[model samples]
Target: MSRPVMGACDACKRRKVKCDNANPCANCSISQISCEHRIAPRKRGRPPKGSLRQLSQEETCESIENATADMIDDSPVNSLFEQDAASDPQATSVLEALATPFSPGTLTTPPSVSTVLRETLGKGSLAAFAAVSRNQFVPNVAHIFQKLAAAVNHQLADEGETIATCAHKCVDIFMQYLFPNTPIAHEPTLRSAAALFDLVGDFLSPEDDETPSIERLRALTLITALCALVNSAMSQGLFSTSKSLTWLFYNASRATLRLYEEYDLEFPHSTSYHIRMWQSAALQNSTGRDRASWHIHGESILLAVRARLYDEDTISRLPQLEAQLLRVNFWLMYLADKTAAAFEARPSMIPNDYLAEKLTLREQGGQDSLQLDLSRPCNGHSLERRLLTGFHLKRRLWAAAADMICELRLFPTRNQVFLANTEVDRPDISGLVERYLNFVGHVDHLPEWLQSPQRALEGVEAHVAEYQAASFWAQRSNIMSVYHCMKLVILQKCIEMAVPEVVGLNQDPIFWAMQKLETSRDFIREVQMVPFVCFKVQGEPAVSVQPFSLTSSVAYSC
Candidate 1:
């Protein structure tokens, strides 16, 4: 057989099939493939048991020194490690301990540093270098690390309560104080979800393979963010606790939200918009108005758009509960966008044409298709529904204000152009005046509840508890603040634009100032009527900056 084949053909061995003792096996011959009988020799038996042995102390020292010396000679920056070793004799011991080699038979551990000193130096260097380098560079970032540590400790402290208990408390606090203002979450749904999250501890762990469903994660994110907001609210006054707890919850919420978004990006959900809105609100509460919060708000709007929230048909097709929430979120974002546009001078992300289209569609769709579903009879007895009604009324005012802002932006007044220093022809002031008048007319048309805080509270059900009544008052205060602030801003702008001869008597400086002063007085009076506890629970006033602006106007007029 061509000098009998020593073993199976390579093809037959590789295939792990039977092979005839021939140069070309029958299987390879039939397949017309190469059948070389080449194979590497295998080890005959197990390795000798006593081949490995521990090195003597002297031998170990010599080996370590030789290795260290070799590393030093081979490294371009050998001088650095030598200098480090010389400056701190202790480094030599640490290196020896860290670099100690283990016998093959012993339970081996990885070296603290890499095998090659060159690679270690290329990286951050050994622990020895860290000591000297830290003193030089640590001061620059020490405060940041200190703050992070404090936040971590605060989070860990937690008053000896578990996360579930804290989450439940946060939910209660949020529902009582913040929900009426935002009302983004459904009470029953949020409570049920919180209860579920309380039971599912494993889902909260990062290392767990059992991933939480999108809805569960969304609830968790919202709850975490709410916790941050509640802590921030609680820590408001001079006597209140430090903001470390707030920072802790805020960071946790952000981390949870990042994970939630990664999942959401693949399988989008409508409630993702709601969670994002809560996060944006929490960011604003904890960090104040910043690009981060604004960007979060923008993302919320994008989520809304993706959900077709602006499309009446799509909204109508959704379940009643989902449609209600989508509507609420849309209006809340619109109010925020308009508020930012008016105060912060940021452009509204929702295009005017889209808003106009939505309005037209709603009007054409009639009462059944109203954006807020105001035509649908709401139970007057339900505090949640009542709060939502108040929000709807507030939404109307904000929509009008937004329209006014858009109009003002389009046609710049003399003062606006002068301030901007743009070389443009003087635009007519009539459009501005008309827009201002239109906004005023819209405010006047608002129901009695919005026009007066007392009337607003009158709508509260008689059977409601004292705390529930307080929530209603708080909600009323928030909406009324927006109302008064919008009027103040418009009147202030008018005052700036007014010319004694060209402007009418109503648009005159004296008339505008009197109106502004009266509005400020009413705002202050309304704020005073709100209980001190309300302020404590609500954290910073909803229109905190507006009050100062009003105060300044009053002082200037005086």
Candidate 2:
């Protein structure tokens, strides 16, 4: 057969079908198409803009790999990466080295789509995918994200049931460990959502029916799955905890927040808002070495204040039942901020002047109507109510301890020295110490049910005893830590005044100082046994104390 010419006619090219060797080609003639043989001269600077040839798969891959390499070398990503990576002996990340044009033993072949996908997903470059996916019906990467979970599971899974199973497992993991500390996303609601999700999964898979709800529900399920996956992996190995957990949770949380921005949709605030709080808590606890959730805490504070969290009058306008719930919620947020500040030696976001509704133990004289009365405590309301009351009481004692600790550092400045002998500061410190001690005595005298771990939940609706126990242990551990820390700070600050002469032993003062030191040591030992439980102060009396967010409305009947 005669050889075909290098280029085809315009008509044949546009049609994208083979042409006959004749002047009018068989394709054009059969379809009654017009064909022209005229050729236009191309300019040197830029080729004619009519129509560019589509690249072959090999060429496309090569182009992408080359362009990516160039961008890495010339773009800001490369600059930032180098700035951070330059500290290493090789001065390059594994990724950077792999991408280099002439790296020894590195693959120089054109990258495959699978390769691209893995690289995109594995590196911090998931963000670019996230940004693309943030716009609805966007071109390019949007569909990639939409189908990301399915595509991933598709490879690892044989059928739809596996995804449903994963979804359930993740929900359990979340509810068990993290959810108890902060039920940001309400558990019961998530339970219902999961049910709906299972239904959605059944409809779309095997049945082959698809719907918009499927998409949204899928995103939500993916979030929990990612969260649980991270936690599960982190629990398994501490060495890679920070790196892996951080990556997984970031994508999960990004997908979560992106749902709101891209779809203009979010789970109802009743649950979603709290879930966000849980995310923040996890991030704070994500890394072993890094325990501070400061940035997240700070963001939460600003948002809370904007929502008038500090305004009791605004909160009181809600239904009497909800008003009580809201009050405890805000109180917990306050304590969280304060605890963070105290630990970091930073100023608190909760301004000292702000008026938080006082939580009071009920007595025969109901003098304080505004304060929550322990007599008609929140225990009887719901399971969460029980937690609210317990946490509120505990946090009050913590705040009291905090006040005593603060008294010791009256003025923190270069020239400021705490003078124990000063008449004015002396009584302030003495009185605070007395108050904290009395408060501990009061806690000791309180009813057993209030202080004991609510494992049986005999009257409560919640069941996970382990989760409750963990939450209780967390609060109890922190309380003891605060107590010891306060005692240590107090005695250490005043040891100069407590015992002036070390040689004579000054009988009473020396003995008292030694006793306080011993108490501090004992508290330290207790904490070591429950290291994870008490690391971060679950200052939120509402959820931290009662992870489920609802407990019985405990009454403090006089």
Estimated TM-score per prediction?
A: 0.60, 0.52
> lDDT score of model 2?
0.42
Report the Cα lDDT for residue 104, model 2.
Answer: 14
Worst 10 residues of 2 by lDDT: 549-558
Residue runs of model 1 more than 4 Å from their true location after superposition: 1-162, 196-209, 237-242, 342-344, 358-380, 411-434, 441-463, 499-512, 539-543, 547-558
Candidate 2 residue lDDT tens string, 285-316: 33311223345345545656656645655655
As for model 1, its CA RMSD to the true structure in angstroms is: 16.3
Error of 2 at 541 (Å): 16
Superposed Cα deviation of residue 486, candidate 2 (Å): 4.6
Error of 1 at 93 (Å): 34
Tens-digit lDDT track of model 1 for 1-558: 545666666555433345675767776787688777554534545558787976433233233334433332333222333444455453343234323111111122323223434444555545533322111211111122233233334344545544556567777667766767766666665666557545533344421212244565566666656666677667644213324445445554554555435446544565676666555555555545445655766787667666666677876776666666666666666666655555445666766667775632231222222222222233233555566666666566666666665555454445577667767656666776666666666546544443543444565545434546666666666666766776666655544545322224464456766766788899899889877666566655454645333221110000
- Candidate 2, superposed: residue stretches over 4 Å from native: 1-185, 194-234, 237-246, 259-272, 288-293, 316-328, 354-383, 411-428, 445-447, 450-482, 494-513, 520-558
TM-score of 1: 0.60
RMSD over all Cα atoms, model 2: 16.3
